[model samples]
Target: MTAGNTGRKRPTISDVARRAGVTKGAVSRALNSGTGVSTGTRERIRLAAVELGWSPSYAARALNGKPLGTIGLVVRRSPEILDFDAFFPSFLSGIESVLSGEEHATVIRFVPDAQTEAATYERLFGDRFVDGFLVTDLRVDDERPAMLHRLGAPAVVVGAPEGSSDLPTITNDAEEAIRGLVRRFADAGHRRIAHVQGDRHMLHALQRRRHWEQAMGEFGLEPGPVEHGGYTIVGGAQATERILARSGDERPTAVFYGSDLMAIGGYSVLGEAGLAIPADVAVAGFDDIPLASFASPPMTTVRSKHRALGSAGARILLDMLKGQAPPLSTVLTGELCIRDSSGDPV
Candidate 1:
């Protein structure tokens, strides 16, 4: 229900909490990422909200000269986009934390798919709804940055731009990432390394893939079997199986997966096949999720500064909403965490 279905006064946060069987404080805590409700309860609240067609946005408030701010999150994942649990939940928490501190509102929505994700950029251009937008999952030919620049709309994208332009974007530091990971792996004495990478279509994926490959090369190790698995555990699993199928002389001694779930999936597959981790094939992952530490063998990976990414994006969006001309780009560094996966591969 796109906005026009309401003739009466719009629902209040109180009304939503009552209907969802939660207290006003619980609702506020869920919305603001404060110390409170469980993840399940929060999902229930958001889902109930979507079903009720309640939106607390600037466009809604404009009806009575009231201001209900909005920060629209645009992602280009498929309806089946798996493991969003890693990136978005934390990033959103960070974003919500910053916005709620300023007493603003946020609206999170999904696009049809890759085809429609680009078109959804038009929503930000609309006269109603959000005062600004927050874009994510950027790709190589992503057109939203340039389009937003031309339109002079307020925005903060989570990925770097392909070319230099006046668009607020926050990106991960690729070169430093490479150097750090290389040092970590070399210190472990792992010579043969492979990478199970993320979607090649995304700019972030390309940067991460390049960094991993470069780090391996700098350490005088042959760039091992790297495959572009589309940022899911299933994708990572398939890539891991392919590498393992190689002959002993052809197989990599260790593997580095793009995300934590992928690494975990690879570990599961290996365990079923009776391959001892570290002893036979070392494994590592990125994201450093809680699950990563609890995996049977405990996967080692990089901790991408996703929360900071969200915060930076929110700050930029708020600035744009305030009509400030902020720099169109930002780059943050990630930390390389070492654990049992590539255990001093001696």
Candidate 2:
């Protein structure tokens, strides 16, 4: 008999089996892998579950050697920092698009420091709270990968670090992106191009900083000032303030911020100093966020698909869960978007 629709408990595997006229064991196999079941029968069972609004419980599924239908994201930052950073939301949306189709849920946790971050990962894995992890905001010499490996947990990292092995990584090459921006500044007759960098601990931040240095040297121009601003408005503002404090002929004529947040923050400082973009001091940034175009002079930036990274990272984890040996890594490339902030469109 089919379970009543008015019950407190959700429709179970039995309900789907009853509605599809299949055995409970068959229902389990169809939902999990559909290996032994015919295509038509699998479709029928899936449709029945949809009609009955039935979903397998993560806890119940875990007991039977199935994925727990959940993914974990442990961020080593406070909630305030997360709220201020636009990349997180956009990235998460991309990840969710794939997870939603797979009928999986994401569990995000915020921790303050490295110790706490490691502890949280250990606790989650030891308790079987997640099937796998989506690791982001990687740092220099990050221990999370090693820790996860020792625990035998599956994970996908969003950034690539030198000498990293075992875990799969998704990365975008910023070398050409930075080279293009520096050339833009040089073509506009800018001799001094300063950079407001993100946290030095992050691999991407270091990559951007190194590219800036190399591009400047290659162009035969003196490398301008480098200030650590991190990826926050306040951090960017302070870094810009320091750059602006220099005397005539000592300050930079153009500034390349590590992220769009830093670029927007620098914009506020320029406004306070009565400096106009591309006229007094040109500006450019990474991660062309939604607000980049809306800024006073429309900030120039690099368009790295944050959503694509999220989706790709999740797909790698899914492959691992299925016991497939996916490629060791995936590298994405970015494009430079010129705007009024960096002079005329190029």
Candidate 3:
């Protein structure tokens, strides 16, 4: 068996140098900075390193105050909640796409609350275990950007939060998209349209709520009941139950959910109540997750490019690592997908 195949110690720089037919100094230069090394020589050294399964030691780099070539992400949510959320996985895939090309890694921490999220960042930064961070799930008056700035930690905020001028931000034009969705509902003759809002603490959820209200006012219609769904299936079901309990004259003819999961939950409750979509209570949801299309009667929703958001944040962070300053803000726009759930023909 080859040295790499054997269950022995990992290959060292010297092994890489021997494999590449280069001096130890040349190997170090190629691995560290590639300065003073020809393109062909650097490629050979990199190939040797890969073939021999040699990678720079993180502990040694930490000791020398060198970059660990990893980005940190602290999400203020439980693992279960994360698993059900469609945006994170797609976003992470985008981040991996960029990091893989640079031979970097991502350190993700899923915390239950803000305190644990803060502590995770502190530990990662104190240990120099990451070169930078990608911050997501922004809140109103978020303190993370300021905290990271104080620590001199380079970070990219995945959502635009207030008082974040010191950091780069990647955001989506969700407000406009939500407005368009509401307008579409109005055009479809949804006069008594209600909204099942996600968590009010989250900026994106609040923005969507505001957009919905604004669109209603613009269309000369009164906003219907606004239920807090907590961005979960159970929450959606509970909220739908409340809506169903309303008197016929007070009931909404259509509902707009903040997330697809909630919409699915709403669908279950609607089905149990024997209500036909669009004919009785039309439905719409946000974050066009994979399951939305396959849902019975399909689902009308906003197709936000969550993966692109992740990729943009990662790209900005990588640029920061390379001593290049990226733009202060980047905004992605999404489209509204009209489906059968909203009374659109199949």
TM-score of 1: 0.78
* Clash count for each candidate, listed in order shown: 3, 0, 0
The list of candidate 2 runs beyond 4 A from truth reads 1-9
lDDT of 1 by residue, 1-346 (tens): 5576665767788787977889887886776443478988888778666667666655445675433477777766554553455888788888988988777777766776755765666755564565667878877888777777776667777877677756667876746655676666677776778888888887877778778877777788788888766777778788888888888678887787888878877997888778898888888788888888888777777888888888888988786665567775688978777777767733
Question: In model 1, where do residues sit more than 4 Å from their true spots?
Answer: 1-68, 79-84
Worst 10 residues of 1 by lDDT: 59-68
Candidate achieving higher TM-score, 1 or 3? 3
What range of 10 consecutive residues in model 3 has the weakest lDDT sum?
1-10
Candidate 3 root-mean-square deviation in Å: 3.0
Residue 126 of model 3, lDDT score: 80
| Model 3, TM vs. native | 0.92
Model 2 lDDT-worst window of ten: 1-10
* Per-candidate local distance difference test: 0.75, 0.89, 0.89
lDDT of 2 by residue, 38-96 (tens): 89889999999999999888777768767887889999877776576766887899899
How are the candidates ranked when ordered by TM-score, highest leading?
2, 3, 1
